[model samples]
Target: MGKLVFLSGAGLSAPSGLSTFRDNDGLWEQYDLDIVCNYQTWIKNFNLVHEFYNKRRLELRKVTPNKMHEKIAEISKRFEVINFTQNVDDLLERAGCENVIHLHGKLLELHCTNCNDITKLNLNDDLEFKFENCKKCQSKLIKPSVVFFGEQAPFYTDLYSTFYNLNEDDLVVIIGTSGAVININYLLRFAKSKNILINLEKNKYINEALFSHIIYKSCDECIDELEQIIQEWNS
Candidate 1:
């Protein structure tokens, strides 16, 4: 059976009241990437970085999945689907979408540098507001399970493997990403399948020519159309 591969970014989660990084009033404007998101400065500015992601984790807990997320979850039940997301948020998983491949990583998880063990953060409890010692290794060197600006993304190999194996009969749908970090133009070169892009506006970083279809609209606004396409393809 042909698979539907959803390559999503911050725009996919924008409707859930999350801030995107590339927009005019995005999070990048509020926080300095050099201090909070750079790997080189992370160790020195550990407190600042931990505080930054802690706040985001709390924010993530408060917001619920929007229509697009729910729609993707519903579609997955009847069709072969795989999600490769640049966004670290768990909105997709919370919406019941399975087979999600987080290229950047997850927000509600911590990685211990000492033991390399990943621990799921408990948002139900009062957040400590500090990077607590890893339970497995008792080391204070725990960072959010996210790829920093200069850090290598270990999950990219999974994404590459998935893309490398895609056949011409498959479908690639990209949503709400500017392609500044993950090169959408380059990655799609491996997909010899139908490519679709859904976004509110044109992205200069993306090579529009590569896409077979493009929709300039909010993800929620295009859900009905997207669902119809997916349903038809699955049938």
Candidate 2:
């Protein structure tokens, strides 16, 4: 009957053979961010945009859910859990969590850039989503469902409403993300009575005083500690 909100980020998916932009030699290092990840680039050259996301989608296909995902799935059973993820991967849903709120659009979906008509990725015999011209619109503009650099997340209004509507009794658990999309200051200001932060390493953006509990440990270690805490509370 209680509620818990999990605000997760790229870090949640990193342990599962995924990488974040901040990691050394990570995905961002290999490409021009402005050209592949920006809305302006999509306008000027859709091919570049397609090329980048195709590689990302292929990379996603090779990975599997890790301990972090399994642990979070276990947490889901104990509370009325609402997951807000900045990650595009479906690993959480794959791990048995449901109704995940993807702050960033997903990699496995496609859309008509002109009409906002979204669809699942269209894969060919090679197991890749083909980005051809948009069939739904005569304009023939098609794009990945992801939120480009200059675009507003489609669900910002819903996310903001959830933040403000949090009851004082609700527990908020934030994992992995650096709070880039939603700043740390704003989260601290709008947080319900209790908040927990779990990250593999220290983020310079975090103020230790703001979190009820600040956990800095490896993914496996964090999972173990969290499970133990949950057990104790249940007992």
Candidate 3:
């Protein structure tokens, strides 16, 4: 079986009207990242964090999967594809992609801060929300079931090992992520070690040498090309 892995970042979801964290013109109504995304801020003011993520969830509810998402799903049918996304959005799953690993977390899942108990919840189109309490112990819920800033990323060791041990012929595709994020950079290196790095970027970053093929284009265009490439490869 041909192995194809995709590592996607925020840009993958931009076509669906999701704003990236790097948007400079205050696309998110001037929401401060540190206030809602950092661990210290979450600890100091859980309500603020909750409200922010809740708003994001509401936005997610309204947005549907875009063309790139559908193309990835179609590509998966021809190859043994694994998607590892830094985005919390569930757009990939909505597009019918299987075996997705959310490196950051999922918007539809919530965990208890005190108990680490995770539960999937149905999201509504509302700016404010609350989730059901933990079954074992009643506690407040948090979004993404993921580690925030200043916290160690969960399943890191396993994620690292999996990336490193892929077969030599495995094709690793990096899409939209910046080269600066340590975890993603490490994974890029791992793909390089296996001699397979196919990266797609709209703009150049520092670690340009890691990719075997670098396509500078929007995710929509890159994914369209990827689908054609996969079809040819499978044939």
Candidate 4:
């Protein structure tokens, strides 16, 4: 049997006191989307881009992993779980899940715009309120490693390799994304594996008939139900 591949999104972390990107009165309402999230603004005002993610980094200090995150970690004990998450947060890692992959990138890591060397920022380190400088080299534009509005996801090479090697018996579960940014076809072509979706609502971009199951509920609740099934199957 193949491993269980989980594709998670913002909803997976929302219960842990983080907000999803597109919800009403969410991040878009608080910040200027064009300035904080777009590429045009990054070039015009790199400092603003830095500030935007810097604030988000600080916010992570207040949150903790919730039941769903812990449960997903527990799943790893029973099966090989490749958690492919679009969220920038480290909630899954904090929840003790091994083998978690961030598709969009991670907020806890920074990259030098000039050298492109990645630095894993320490959550406990009291970084000055200003943008941090690169440690390896004297590079100026050290920014969060996240995939921004115009940037292609940097992990596609690894993702493609994983999908190419996916077995037909592998279970693919997509949760929380509304089909906004990621090209669903990119994942679908290689997912000859069994497929399912767990979301607050049906994803408009996906053909409903394609999935083996569709569960409309909070990801936390759906995962609880799925866990029961898995436990029974194992027993």
Candidate 5:
């Protein structure tokens, strides 16, 4: 099978109208990253944490999948595509792509922190902020199962193993995410050690040695080029 794995970041969704996790000002707008996203913050201020996520969930409803998303979905038809995205939006799935792995967590699914029971939520403009209670235990429900800062990333071992075991000829695409966080820098190194082709957007601080080709463009533009490259390779 043609192996092509894509690791997408916030940049991939920007064209779709979703705001990046960090704005140009280096904050998620009004909220400090540590005070609202860390484990201590969640334990100290559950209500505030819930409110922050609820706001993000509401925003997710307003965005639509961009051309880049569509192109990725279309490319998957001819290749064994594995999309591991940091984005919580459902755009990739909406674009008809399968085998998507969400590293951060999805915005549409809610989970009871007490019971760990996950359920899909329907979002609308009229959506009210009602704290859902777990049916089994009657405990307060939290937002979807996601890995916040200071929390160990869920399924780290599984993801590592999956990528490590892939054939040497497999292609790995990294988009929009920074060189750090979610252990992406480590994964990039691993891919490089094996001489796998790594593609990513040109970021100044990112170690240039890790990537085979650095596309100096946004994710939307990169996807357009990627689609063309894949088509030519297949032909």
Candidate 6:
């Protein structure tokens, strides 16, 4: 009867063949984040940004959920699980997890700049960058739904609310986040609960002191240990 809040990032989906922005040959290397993923210059490089995300959408369709994602989905069936992910991919949904909240928005969706109506992109065919009209308002200012660096995340309010409402006995599990975009320490300040951190590498940005338990391993590598810890906590 306990709540488990999973604060997952790109690492959660990395095992499924998706690349993180920080990866050596990752998207960030191929394209400058300031030019491609920054909201301030989004309009200036509209076609470039669209092309980048369009390729990502196509790549997402080719990969399947890994063991870690499937395990998390299985755990959700037995516990009160809430997912807050910074990733734009739908791998968690594809792995059968329900009601996963995307903190950074999603890739397979386009929002009208003028009307702000979100439309699901068709991945059945090859995606290309084009100024598509909005389905609802018929405005021609559509862009990828993912939140850029300079834009405000619409779901941050929900994230703060979720943390503030938590009980001290609840568990907060942070996975694969480097605290680059979202400050881990600041977010955890609202949660009066035990915390866990799982990451593949050490990040200077993250304060290791915050977590009661820390695992420096990939999500897939530590799934068994992670499940055991969660089970013990629930018990």
Best candidate (score: lDDT): 6
Better model by TM-score, 4 or 5? 4
Arranged by lDDT with the best first, the candidates are 6, 1, 2, 4, 5, 3
Displacement of the residue 1 alpha carbon in candidate 2, Å: 4.0
| Ranked by TM-score, top first | 6, 1, 2, 4, 5, 3
Q: Which residue ranges in model 6 land beyond 4 Å of their true spot? A: 122-126
Would you give me the overall lDDT of model 2? 0.76
Q: Which regions of candidate 1 fall more than 4 Å away from where they truly are?
A: 24-30
lDDT winner between 4 and 5, please give it.
4
Q: Deviation in angstroms for 10 in model 5?
A: 0.6
| lDDT tens readout by residue for model 5, 161-200 | 7677766567777777775565565676666322222233
* lDDT values, one for every candidate: 0.83, 0.76, 0.69, 0.76, 0.69, 0.85
Distance from true location, Cα of 90 in model 4, Å: 0.4
Kindly give the stretch of ten consecutive residues in candidate 1 with the minimal lDDT sum: 21-30
Question: Which of the two candidates, 3 or 6, achieves a greater TM-score against the reference?
Answer: 6
In the order shown, the candidates' Cα RMSDs to the true structure are: 1.9, 2.3, 3.0, 2.3, 3.0, 1.8
Model 2 ranges off by over 4 Å: 24-27, 122-127, 231-235
Q: How many pairs of residues in model 5 come into backbone collision? A: 0
Model 4 residue pairs with clashes = none
Clashing pairs in 6: none
Residue-level lDDT of model 4, residues 43-106, one tens digit each, is 5778777777877888889899988788888888779778888888989999998778898888
